[model samples]
Target: MKVAVSVLGLAAIAAAHGYHEEDQTPIEGPHNALWYNTLPGDGGTQADSVFSGISTFGRIQYHPCLTSRSVKYDIAFIGAPFDTGTSYRPGARFGPSGIRQGSRRLNLYLPLCSRRVGFSGGYNVPLKANPFNSWAKVIDCGDIPVTSYDNGYALQQIEDGHNLLLSRAPYTDADKPGPAKKDRTLPRLITLGGDHTITLPLLRSINREYGPVSVIHFDSHLDTWKPKVFGGSPSQQASINHGTYFFHAAQEGLLANDSNIHAGIRTTLSGPSDYENDGYCGFQIVEAREIDKIGTDGIIKKIRERVGTEKPVYLSIDIDTLDPAFAPATGTPETGGWTTRELRTIIRGLEGINLIAADIVEVAPAYDTNAELTTMAAADTLYEVMTLMVKKGPLSGMKEKEERLELKA
Candidate 1:
């Protein structure tokens, strides 16, 4: 009788605590169930919570763009998880996952005063837009299945994987017109890369879709090094490293002649002839020191003049483009590079250019601080890139703050 009374008392306490053993009760009213239990695009899979659900770039919806032919996206965040091409650091193979993890706080629906506020997808005040909330259908397509044993095979995998995603027709939207290359309205890929070498394969893949596209290469090193100068001869694998991939790309006729530009270059070269060789590969250099002499707007103007606003441009950013103080976790750590703000400002200035595809590469999270500074910087830089894309093309019809302020004036 005492045990039975104890059990009844426990049941009463459980009830008081709002515990239900046989509870299959449907959630009622305007509660968190709408945010937690529903799928993405409905209420979202609670990925917006930042602490919950699968980690994707910006907590965006995930789609198997590589495996499924039916899945279409206007902007797909694909990962190239191959870092065997790195000469100085090896941990960048984990860059794709690290970048995604760092991007968790992005695209969040804020919870305030124990109540969900008006739906806002992590707005960018400077750009006056939220890319996640934009009309473009953006999704994280996950990482490429790249091999680690052989660099040659791994590069091919990256090429094929990028091509697979790039070839897919974009999700149809009226306000978001897909960038056109050869009469086909194709999707854009914002790639999270393993290392700088991945850009070569990506360029090869993009060349198929858009032909010889102009390149906006951002790094502390000129990647257009000759095979023999960087590493080669005995092993061909040694030739096509992160330092020399752009050389291969140029040789393959994948780059637009005289239209490609490399900004933030500060690496110690073999000689002045290296710059000549870089010119032969069709890339104009904007040295890192130029930032001090000319400033961000000047650098932006130079890039705009070089690549032009008309042609399809591939934007490739190595994390080392930022100073080691800002982004220390990279294959190559160059001290005197642009700050994240300067880089973002330059990227934002390229608002009117035709950007077909882009990648943020060489983010080795293993070398990052406990705060994940490098990883966060990389993700935020990509966010800026995404904003640029969101504002361009058909979406450019929207008026900017400058335009609105001018009207008031």
Candidate 2:
């Protein structure tokens, strides 16, 4: 009886621990398979997550504490998850979190590529710059802690949050030469947006620093249509919708007129009023189809020439700028857009420019599939912009006029 009982117990144990069908190998032991770092918190009330068995991007060695204030930050990776202003779709409020989830695993290898990518072949061949793999002082400052329910209040909160980050001192001065590393040292903001509307608050923050910087906008839509054009009361002229914020921006003298340019635009307009608004804002339009004609090099040349080597630039990317085939998870995704590779290459060509601040927005993850394609694209775009911030000036031929025109905050 005892022998029979022991035989049954072994069978039950083996049944509980399944085996691989291919080779009939048992799964690894519990300790071997266990992951996640867990520790006791202060006073032993809760447990702190210091180190897990597996890789954790949030707790990566170089990442600073979210509450850290004394240490000067070169860039604060902030999330503004507000999608209140979307015209057609509305899942963008989850963009920041989706992006974070997609980029949870970080290393030198390209997530989509077969080999490691960094500072290698230029646009024609293309390469992904893995800045996070370096000693970049990047910290996930968490989200903007935005409140839902009210549109006006949300914008106010978002603006206030950015203002506080902007107000922090002891940040790197990337423009200073000699002792400090010019581009690496200067303080900057890289926002993982709630939606395109977040740019208005960001621009408002940057305008306080650069006093109306030029804009390098990458989007499938012009986004300069008037509030009424989008259908609203004239009294709602001051209203701040994602589609109409740029119009308000132009109205408020927040953008450097004639220095702003839009790339990848394919959205249909309401006629002459659209041109009038764009003209009023002094924006040069580079239609999406023009990419085939200009190629990446020509596009870079145009952007360089449009914004020039000098003057502060605010780079804004609405993920819908890429073809829905590559990024279908956006709210108002326009078809016939640039491919992920094309978009990444184009952004790479924009290296070594005088970039002051930047943002990547409109990543509505609800429509995204389990694969997380759109969120990953937004994350990749953020990495490219971070590299651009890293690869700033004293260009090959750093002209004196160019130096003078380069505004420092």
Candidate 3:
């Protein structure tokens, strides 16, 4: 995937030399203070260009806990902060904090022009112009608070929080009596993630609101295994377990078209007939070797065709989808898998599609060293998605300007 460069001219200069400087400015101001560090100097045109009058990065203002409307954002960043569903390494619950701490260093202003052309030998195209200049808004609502002991309750809380954001509450008549009533748009929930299973509840809530949602699930395992069957009633235990999310989703009628739920499944452990029957049930299964054979563009095209352009898409990325060489510490690292670049290419290709929400899950920081690869990859992916959102409009304006400049030349 082509990594879009940050707009700060100074960082461009610094990056040329392979060093990322940490900006130490306090974040108590209106916008994130780290953004100011990307400037050419302490005070420069680059700094002014990226941070001028931008009160916040995304929906998250500095010191979010102190804010009254806790859910104040077009996009909310809730953390599941749990890994109880993992069939393997038990530390993915720490993923949210680790990713957050690592991501705090990001400036969040991606200049579309910085994207490298011909990244996939012309398979991928750069945005026609820079979108950051167009003023699209995003907010980082605080992470969802999860209790350590009760996984089921924690999952319910996550669903409740997302529902609050998704539900449109009436504007208080006491504040402003209205002969005129306007429906407030609910925030688009972007979860930081606890485990892959955390997605089940989030998906359930989304399905309730919008009907079946098309899922683009990226993972090493099939996650379609049926949890061990118990007497009479199906156990809720298996319903929300990490490995069985997709299976449960399918069984529960949460998926619009089973084919729309493309599973980029590479690794696996065999269990029941249901697990093996995923491909039969309409999932567009793209195995690891298939990704290697056809490349990112092929897989992206397949996804686009299956999901279609108009449908609201939900992206769920399990950190283990990446090759262990690049993201070694994920709960279930497969030996061979897609490179981080490949994943980015696939994500970038979905630029114009209606992406309602996304999440990066199952990152176990305890298994990582330096936390360098996973952090960098996760942050870059978020930037790419945000840029995609911007490029759909404001960023396109910049592209138009670039075209005019080229014509003049």
Candidate 4:
């Protein structure tokens, strides 16, 4: 009797809302009109509020570039959610999602005054341009599926995912004239890393296309430590870690000699010999305190002179490069690092350099504060990178390399 009374009560509640078992569909009412959804759909418009949609990097449109051959994109944001290579901390696997969540306000609605002036896309006042409004077809490719149990498999997955995007033809619109002249142009990838170790596989994938590109590594530690000094293991796979991945990269010929550089380094090395070994691994150091003596422009000049403008360059940014006060949620936080604003200015100063690919890693959001400072810094730095790519357009070396191969044939 009690169960029957409960069923009757549910039926009464449903009847109050005008429900019928046979209808099976919503009844059209004034409140149920489609016109209520004045916000923009996923068709790439700024009508929706920043808080009201699926989270993507800067609320950009998402496409599965790995599985779809028809999908065209010039610059794709991919997430590498593996952090097994971390030595000190282990929560960087969550870095990718954390960075995305912090990027909610990046491309929000335009300002009232700017809208009156006939501006449409989201704008960065410092950059003086809107990357989303640029000609490069940009999309978020989601995250790479990596297994956490085995480091080797996870690293291989990163390399494969990066290579797949690199193999796709760049999206081009005939109405909008871009920097690429070739019919078959490769796309640039902006990777959200799981850890600093992820750079090894990324560089390996980049080597297949650009052939040992110069690396502009921004970190607080000299990641080029030899395996013996970093750590040793019986298993060869276990030996390749975040602190020693650059040594492996050098061994595999994935780095261009005399062109790579490390900026903002201030870690206490094992000894002075570590610096000598670092030089042997092909990286010139720019200490963290050099900013006081030379300033940002001076450091930028040094990096520009090191990598130059002709060869392909890969940028690897470890979030620990920023001081802990600015970004505390990293696997390896070092004191006396650069500020977020200073890093943005330095990245913007690198405009017109041949940046083929880039990654920002080591953002372990578990250690972050309530303000989400670390993730916000990583996202805004990524914004600067995207803006830099838009300002420079596509790499011209893609056409030149293909022509060289054709000549050999």
- Winning model by TM-score: 1
lDDT of 1 by residue, 1-409 (tens): 6644655565566567554544312212234455542112334222234576688998888988788989988789999988888778888989999999888877665432111122335667788777886778899999989989998999999999999888867774423333345356677899998999999999999988778989999999998888887766358888998999988898999998999899999999767887887788888899999999899999999999999876678999999999999998999898999999999898888888888899999999999999999999999999999988887843223223234556989
For candidate 4, give the lDDT. 0.81
Off by over 4 Å in 3: 1-71, 108-125, 128-134, 168-185, 229-235, 269-276, 279-282, 393-409
Candidate 2 lDDT, 277-354, residue by residue in tens: 678877998888998887878877888889985566789999999999999999898888999988888898887677
lDDT of 3 by residue, 18-49 (tens): 43333212122333443333323332122222
Range of the 10 consecutive residues with the lowest summed lDDT in candidate 1: 111-120
What is the alpha-carbon lDDT for the whole of candidate 1? 0.81
Sort every candidate by TM-score, greatest first.
Answer: 1, 4, 2, 3
TM-score per candidate: 0.84, 0.74, 0.71, 0.83
List clash counts for every candidate, in order: 0, 8, 12, 0
lDDT of each: 0.81, 0.67, 0.61, 0.81
TM-score of 1: 0.84
Look at candidate 3 and tell me the lDDT of residue 65: 28
- Which run of 10 residues does model 2 get worst, by summed lDDT? 110-119
Q: Which stretches of candidate 4 lie over 4 Å from their true place?
A: 1-46, 110-121, 173-184, 397-409
Query: lDDT tens string, model 4, 247-299?
Result: 99999999989999999999997678878878877899999899999999999
